[model samples]
Target: MTTFYAGLLSPCALACAVALALTGTAHADDNADKNTHTLTPVVVTATMQDSPLIVVTDPKQPRQPVPASDGADFLKSIPGFSTIRKGGSNGDPLLRGMSGSRLNILVDGGMIAGGCPSRMDPPTAYIAPQLYDRVTLIKGPETVLYGPGNSAGVVLFDRNFERYTQPTLSGDASLLFGSAGRSDQNLDLRAGDSTGYIGISTNHTHSQDYKDGDGNRVHSQYDRWNADATIGWTPSDQTRIELTVGKGNGDAAYAFSRMDGVQFLRESTALKWTQEHLTTHWEKLEVQAYTNYADHVMDNYTLRTPDPASMMPMAMAADVDRRTSGGRATGTWRWGDALELQAGVDGSVSVHTHRAGGPPGSMMGYYKDQPRMRDARMQDIGIFAETRWSFAQSQRLVTGVRVDRVQTRGYTLEDMAGMEHMESMSGVDAMAMMPAQTAADRGDTLPSGFVRYESDLSRSPTTFYAGMGHVERFPDYWELFGQHVEGTLDSFRALQPERTTQWDIGMQYHGDRVKAWVSAYAGVVNDFILMHYPMTSMGVDYASNVQARIAGGEAGANYDFTSHWKADVTVSYAWGENLTENRPLPQMPPFEARWGLTYEATQWSIGALWRLATAQHRVADDEGNIVGQDLGPSAGFGVFSFNGAYRIDRRFTLSAGIDNLFNKTYAEHVNAAAASLAGYVNTTRVNEPGRTLWIKLDAKL
Candidate 1:
């Protein structure tokens, strides 16, 4: 072991490390089923990169260090995913090397749009992982059953309140306490008779600012809560209908932005119906409708005292809201023993509004001067078809296609502070970039599709596959309307749609005592949308189109030795470049790997994990996403951690862990620099949390 490793092993020096995603180390008894037990290491069931890629798993299980606090935090456990951290919670997710609208996310098959133009609340921010029954990640632009604008990938969070054969009652709950005033509580209760049922799920989390390995406060504090209820009617064994309602609220302080979110309120409602076995050929049918709304408030004085010596020396606040509604219908068909098909049509419409004002000794008077303004509205309609063909017992082929029509309307605020800040320009066509006086509208048609082939090894428990896919995405509201340059051009009017063509391949193997998988992908993008960091123009980044190529892969392996010992390893890497500019793609994460070891017994388990990253010398300064631009280069780092658990009974389990065993101060490459306390322009990315300890209890009945 190197000096660093040696130090990490020492109890006194165990100080730093946290991406919150530790190794899914195996700590199972001889007969523990990987899927049912939350205490065992999480298994990564891989598929070909081109396989319309879907990885489905129970989101309620405990894995790695512990359960995630939010959707973005939960994604870190998956391959080819990372987060743009703002604090302990509410990090924005990044897939491959893409951010923003590139990653389309849906909750219970519904779109929940964030109100912040700066992404203070990403789609995932509203998520409480433990409340969802299942989490699925579909990589690449392979399939488009979901609404348009997902050139990078799609994420789905769902809960299936299954009916009961007879009268039944069940529920699960968990409680957690950790360092730095960390605490969490979650509960899920369900009951149903053959005819109907009602259920509810709720969760809460709170934490204070945590210190870095060097004992420096990171300026991150947050508290949040979410609650949801569902009612279902089972007309017959083959038919069902359900209605769901949910509400969430929270407040958070961030070191990265000038202001903090004083309020994040969310509301959602959905109704769905399903029918099964209509005919031998038609296996099932499903219909769904939903509405989601988000209201947010950001202020310099509410979460933290405003620095009188800094920019906007006076207190300021902004309130923004977004409303979205959509519906979908899908049918599943089976043809003989050789084919199965699913076809669906879905659509969504969204509208945004904003208001802002400042400085009054009396807080009640500030809002009187702020006027709410309508900004943007968008609607999309899509139809999709997917099928699987089985030519042989061991071979299969999967294919899918989709087309989407989208329309966008904008009411550009001409008298806004940013618009009036710098209206003059020396270069570029300015007038052509401006929108219509009152409102503007644009429309486009997009198409996406994918195909894949898979075959099982004739002699082993193994599978391999290869596939190709193409996707065209329309410009999103942020890409087109949020990014504006001084006198040069309105990026919204200048930015072009993005088109991507890609190939993916990979393999998976399972043995008596070992399991492994590998996946890789490469793609070429035409008019790739790129966002440059904020410059002299204002606080907003500039979006432009450029030709680009991207490649990446992820691999993992696990082995069990005897009944008491097990080991696992995983690695992920991503690469990209702007072919038009001949420069490395900005905001790419460095090559990373993780190793873990565990010991287990009938009632107790212990484990350790070491996370490692390669130095990223790759640089493309002043260019990146809305959250951050690449800041030259960052050094590699490794952090160690330890965990243990005890099962009290079939209904209860207790676990605890020490993260960043050797509090080694480190920062990720994909991060935004946080502002300092003195109101100074601190562009240095915030350091991750240092050594921390936590304990949790899981119970069910």
Candidate 2:
């Protein structure tokens, strides 16, 4: 398996091929014909519309081979997505070499960000994929319909409520068990009649520390639970209104950090109204409003015993919270079925605050005596419009434009006991705050848009398209308030907005025996955000802006050699350079590819998957995104896995898989270094899990 993964495709060739694999997934054909009903482990990638690539998948379906514990783990199955591993769960996701706010992640049209300045919990960490109906990824600065930034891309976890003409009850439930004390249970139940409906979903997962391929334990354990409900009313055939409420809480242990998350609380609410088949030229209308909150608590003693001799030799804890609220209104129009238009206005506002205490023993519980310090406030309002015009029999033009008002403010900083920001670790203000005794506010007017052209070949089953886009991104909380910039910043006003211009193109081909696609992009960026770690030997990782250039793409193909036999191949690659310093941009990963072979039968099926990565030589010491920095070049590695599934009647299915068949000890290049724990003093990339077996049972009604 290693020989096949490492030798079938050359590093340089693989990168080039993936750049042309425009759709980035072998399931493009399946996505095009959505009416078909089939079961697969998961659908990681796909293409939609005429511009860019949007990999869409039904979250209710059980993917084969691997089942992820969180959003980031699931996304890594797709090309162009990687994660910074701190442990088994809560790994921060990176896209096309970009992390943090540049990706524009949204949950049910609302934003909820964790408060750890070090990014211990990114938006993806809080997501439970099974709770949502669909996951959509829009690669690069492809479109303006979602929101701002998107230099890396846009990720959307959404839910769809379908109305019924008669009373009906439906949903799915599943149970999963795996190695390292892994276990999970999930249920999604919904019931309703023609006029109204109600739906509910709940999930629970728990695991203990897992051993690596070498039989050495790693501090990667977690416990979590989530529940949500939706109520909808269908007053008429063309009108519907829905309301949703959700709550979740969890705790986790990490191997590389001094603190563990003792509490992760999430609360959310949303309301949406839709009216279709409107009068005149109006096609539809949608209006929505939502609010999301995150309350997190981290401590050194809650999940692990204190290391008396370590740097953090005592127990410490911190409490932080953030709240975000947003609203959107949109209208759809059509002209003779040849042209379609969508226009809308969207806005969001967020507030962040924190309090910390501890050291010799433990901090005051409940942050009762500590003073609440309001540190960050952000707001955005935008107007956008997009159109699709079929100007010719086999050609179409797609374009969109958006304008936004962005603002950010930082207030007085003081922890419990009246400690100042620069004098304590409250903000992880290790480097120091922007010296703001009084609140400081900054705002900007930003513009972004994209245009795409597509053509369908009449003589062949194929399609082709190209697009170009430009986007201006406002600096996020971590970039502006999380760190300092010496004499140039303190009100942190020196940071500039990120500007990007890129070109994208791709094509897809479908045939009875052959299915394939290629996608590629190249772009230039101005004032790109770069996190410089340990600036001035003060242990501060601060944000800096510099010019840069980037290019890369993904490609894949599948062939059915026989009625019951099939082969699939996929590759992904990315390249970047710091124009100002002429060095390779930090944290860029090496070539990666996946190969799979499978056989299908009447009641059962089996498959094998091989994942490979090339050794990376490019390095920019101590430079990367907010989550982590590049340690150095990493060695290449590969792993082989196998899976099988059987239908146990009409309503139930059983599936099992063995990962890392050889128990090969390997680590990913884009990962955190080993912690300096007492017994585990070595500092190398954290090894992946050893050979393990997993089984899952899926049931639906």
Candidate 3:
């Protein structure tokens, strides 16, 4: 596999060759207390607002235009997030204007189901946000304790394992170098006592093929790797148990596809349990279980070459897989400080499969020697409850409820030749045959909820909130077996089940040099699940149900006007409509903004950023929602960047940046379009990238 991803670009020399092949260790600590600690001067733009529509980021610090090998480029550094660009990495993430499964992404809370069907791997493309350590976002659809349609909200990439105070060892590492021949590496380690602990992490990234600002080029290249492990026990001090495992793989190169993804592969495992103060109001109890899998492959011969005017001109390949499994349990209660509670039950299930191979040239392992077939299967089960009530003296109220039972099953008509070879291995143009069915079960019973109210103003450090939510989504799996319905023989028993109902309001502020926030929302969906696409290329691809309307907002701030100067700002907006065809709304995303400045010095820092965006002429252009669509009206731009950091102590730190510092050639309006590759330069969507530079280094122990 390219020499194991080119030796993972030296993750501290593979963690010192796995610590000298296990145990022939070396130790040396205490270099004057690790240089008297002092760090935290990088994170170019992540407006941090941890309340009022929450957003908490910190994936091991280090941000700025790069650093984010995935998880949709670390959620586009936050501000109502946006992505759909399918080039440099897997892209696909949009919140506010909502996208796929109404945005609920969890990792560590388990759920990784992406087996193409034209999504080309999403679920944050198998995540790898610096091997996760915290990233929470909750906006809109308030909360129902994760899972089950988020109505454009919910994101968690958590990981926190503590309890090990006596015999210990810690770790961290990083390296990067960017701009076209980008590179990355990371490492993390841990060891323990206090009854247990063990952790490990690994990462790698690669890039090449980037050019834009009219300097053409653009077939985007990529490479990736990951490794993970965790084990915990902590036998006392309130009990605990944990386990985790992971694996990852990658390949990418797509100028908006026509095949190329050459496999993604991933596998995961999880288990957890906890008990804390277990009585006095039954104060805590939890449990979890999980499994995740994704195995994808796409090909037009590794990474392109076969466009001799499209339509299967040569070799081909397709392979898909999904597994997914789930479990959850929760309990917590309290009353002393007024109130608190949480109750839970959760579930999941998935199973999809596919297979296909070549047209000539034996295509290497020919779809790994074919034979997968299984079509579909999905599942969900739920029960939840949440609460918090601090009645007066600063007021508070928060609530939640959930109930679910969703299902889907398909595969008969003898699998219709594996769904016509999985829609002729996705280069589209083929899919209209399957009219003798009997094997497409479906079911539903969803219900979600939310409610909120809070106040803490007495004299202002500000905090005020308002909320309301409702969800009822269940039709995923690419809106039921990936598109094409009109004379349906089962777009999985004919789509349905969308239903959102939202309203959210916000406010938050924390003083001493200022911090601020604002949020807003509005919703009403009712069966909204659109997707249509097929103005030619053999025409076909549909899926319906309408009546929509959505609203958006996001705002941010940070000030510090001088203690080394600082400033920040943010804004975001989204709007949608299709009130059953009244128009406007199809990949909506426009009106964005950002600005920042910084100087700080205690260990050095410097920063700047700009980024505007605003031309999106609202047009349903072939609609959208399942990875992408609506590639029409769009044009707006602005870009600037800068960065610097140093903290060459506390075990090291160094950062750098310069992304599109001026070579702007924008393009992003719900991207993905630009396919006519055979030497690249097809542009319509896929542009952004030019004037880049990077550097990074970090270490700790």
Candidate 4:
């Protein structure tokens, strides 16, 4: 470990020295450039709209959002994005009241599956935020061309090659230090000319156990590293091709879980082609292809001592590996004065294999004894089109439609252990029945459509829009396999697909000193997939189809005062009910509000934020028996944080902040508790981290 740390730091230190030397010589040039031009606001890809630095389109963005400590941490900043927090890093994302397979998460256009049936190494855990250029999120069922049945939405964390018209070389380096002995270092390098470009990025981060609000040392330590490179070629004015490859690995310990995360690794590759034509009616065309591979392993006795009575005692281990390959082709056409259209077709195929077993204490022993659970394959294909038309100067219409086809197959193995367990329990010398091996297949076709009308207020700086959409979603993997059920193999016996009809309305107001936006939506679902658990046989849970209705809205505003002081506030609320039972739906996020105040100057800025949540009492009567059940109404709480940043020069800057100012302890309603253990029974909701302080230094050349 010491040698690895030294190797990573040595190059960074040398690069920093070189950057400092160059900064001294480049100061005059930078000063003249800065004096002649103004800086452009940094825009995020989460929404199509452009916003200023301090404004967040997603309601979930907060300074420290429960001490993220990883990629999942940074993602929760978006509105409607939550996580199944189980202490520290590697939390699973839950978006817009949906979770697990319902949400499609991609890193650099690659899909990585986790190893743990409990989802310890969520896909997001393999991603290194510092390596990506942009993180884009599409909420709800608005866009399905990106991947398979993304009922919740799509999250694209991407890194793009630098575009240049002339020969150029650039790079940036950063170092971060924080409480709990946390440290991180990153480097980004790019070199390009008129005809091509090449780039590379790498980062490493580590942290020790952190103390929570109650001054207890939480067993949450992690170490991670990543490196990737890309090359692009542009042979002509309107044609370009790019290729990329990357790899990453890490290990971490969970404070709330009984076992430590032993090993995580990922490899990915992608190719993209873009072309623009001047003679044809089609203005542009884009095509992309990519393949991703993930290998993961988890053990009970790797990082910590294992409990004797635990299921995974004596170094029990499990492994899961998955591969995904897919591509898409898109085209845009312009017709007449007020009409334009864009169309695309995309698809992907993924296969996963899981293996477990081993000798009592040997690494290979676990694999020798355990039989394979199942091998699964999934494929999806979709075609989509969108059009924009201008009815008048102040009014416009946007419409889109998509059709998708999905197929899934799983091969089951003979249950040798199941027969043995049954014979042992019977207590009589009886012959074990042989179960036949079988294969299950499922296929479905779904359609989605949306239409919207937008207009600018007659005489004010206000824009308002109303939209309606219908989306049909295929049931996801978790709903199919995670839940316990019989005869699921029969297509007719499977849970029905979820269909949603929804309406959305929103308004935006932009002024010289104030900016505000509000949006509301209502959705009705036919055959919504709901998980139910029974208390029989030591507790069992399963998913079933049910009719449901859901409605929600979000509002946010920011105001600037006296050039240095500013205030911002945002709020969100959601409600859901099962129509058949006439009761509240499960796992609904409570109403919440966030307020912020900040002061700024040319070289420095400071800010503070306050977060508040309303107590929730609404819960489905049959929702608490599942693994992640809503434990009834939850109490509300408030938290505060402070942040600051300073620019030492054009080439250098520093940022620092303290999160959870008061170290208040609280739990989110959607979080899941760790699985029960023999000696450590943790049935309560997952607890959040305590206060943390951090400082970061950044430099560019």
Full-model lDDT for every candidate:
0.78, 0.78, 0.80, 0.69
Model 1, TM vs. native: 0.89
lDDT of 4: 0.69
Q: Report how far residue 164 has shifted in candidate 1, in Å.
A: 0.3
Tell me the TM-score of each prediction against the true structure. 0.89, 0.89, 0.33, 0.88
Candidate 3: tens digits of C-alpha lDDT, residues 151-254: 88888998778888699887777777888888777777788989989988877788988898878989888887788788899988798899987778878888
How accurate locally is residue 198 in candidate 3, as Cα lDDT from 0 to 100? 90
lDDT, candidate 4, 301-371, per-residue tens: 66667777666567666777777788888888887658878899988887777787543657566563666
How many residue pairs clash (N, CA or C atoms closer than 3 angstroms) in each of the candidate models, in the order given?
10, 20, 1, 11
Worst 10 residues of 3 by lDDT: 21-30
lDDT of 2 by residue, 376-491 (tens): 89999999999999999989998999999999887753222233444556555644454436566789999999898888889997889899989999998888766332222352
Question: Comparing 3 and 4 by lDDT, which wins?
Answer: 3
Q: Judging by lDDT against the true structure, name the best candidate.
A: 3
